[model samples]
Target: MRLRRSARIRGPGGSFLRRPPLRVNVASPIELRPSPDGRFLACGDQVGWLRERGYGVDSDGCRALELYEALYLVERGDAAALGADGAPLDVSGLISLGSKRNPRFLTKYIVYRDLRNRGYVVREGYGLGNDLRVYRRGEYGSRDARYLVVALEEGRRMSASTLGRIYLRALNLGKELVLAVVESHGDVIYYSVSQFNLRRRLDDAA
Candidate 1:
């Protein structure tokens, strides 16, 4: 979906309020089916629309939406991907399914929603050691993803080695590593992580 440019609007207090980019409405609700693999949601029709919005991958003839993408669509009321019972799922219902599928759904959803609200195009970060791959606004197809982002809850403990490994992977892939921390109150803060190599200094002749 194309995002409308940011604009300023008058507030109740007569102060100008800045509006974030708005996504264009989908023509109609897209239909999604659960794949037998259980790793993705498949759409038999309107696959092109989903693709144009950077939602999923085309497998054979169908578009396969990532679990996160399906959840996001449900949240936006753009699509009604069927559940196991072949019924449409609401946001909460989708969340339940996602949580059952992946234990980190809550934290990931917080970070995903935050990024989308900021106007970035986000997709699953498969094989990238992150939760989402983000493309800057207006740069989805023209350029590669600018950032690979991982979500963590505030004050959550992570081993230094794990962080180092993620940093190294991002470095190797030429992508920036972003850590999105969701606080208890649902606020999010982003940290950029990168690796720097320092050459050892040679000792003077003793």
Candidate 2:
């Protein structure tokens, strides 16, 4: 299936996309990461830093931060109380926290988790010469499923067919037997549903 509607995502990490006619409730730039390697950008809303203010403030930001942390824990397949971000929500005496506040950690964590659940064998950092890579289960040869070759845009526009070929070759699929796309925008993420068959395309080409 195709992406039903594109989300309105823009900022430092995104190239110029045709702006949507209507506004959408999209997360701000702070919510997204430029790449997995740039791990220093912080996205918390100042709740975790209140302890530095020195005693007696309500620490409401701490509560929201804890909530987000709890959500992240659930997404990471950890038990709800493992305390992925803050101290154990159940305990009252200790407050363990992450030294860095970059929200990109959460973004990468979510993307990897979602793709893994979608039956893709995901490779996190660049793979086999491709900047990013994904594969469907089954034999490696014969190009039996779709793959995405992710790229940041350059000045010129490239055709979809070119992208499809690059993805196939980078993943060692040999020829034009795979479904692929060059996803240009970093923030506008895409997910594939495996109902589409690459074997059908290879067979059609043959």
Candidate 2 TM-score versus the reference: 0.28
For candidate 2, list the clashing residue pairs, or say none: 41-102, 42-101, 47-61
lDDT of 2 by residue, 105-206 (tens): 333333333444444544433332223344555432334334553432223344545444554564464222222222334333453413244344445555
Range of the 10 consecutive residues with the lowest summed lDDT in candidate 2: 90-99
Name the 10 consecutive residues with the lowest summed lDDT in model 1.
197-206
lDDT of each: 0.69, 0.32
Residue 164 C-alpha lDDT in model 1: 67
Candidate 1 error regions (>4 Å) = 1-24, 39-45, 127-130, 196-206
Backbone clash pairs for candidate 1 read none
TM-score against truth, every candidate: 0.78, 0.28
Number of the top lDDT candidate: 1
Winner by TM-score = 1
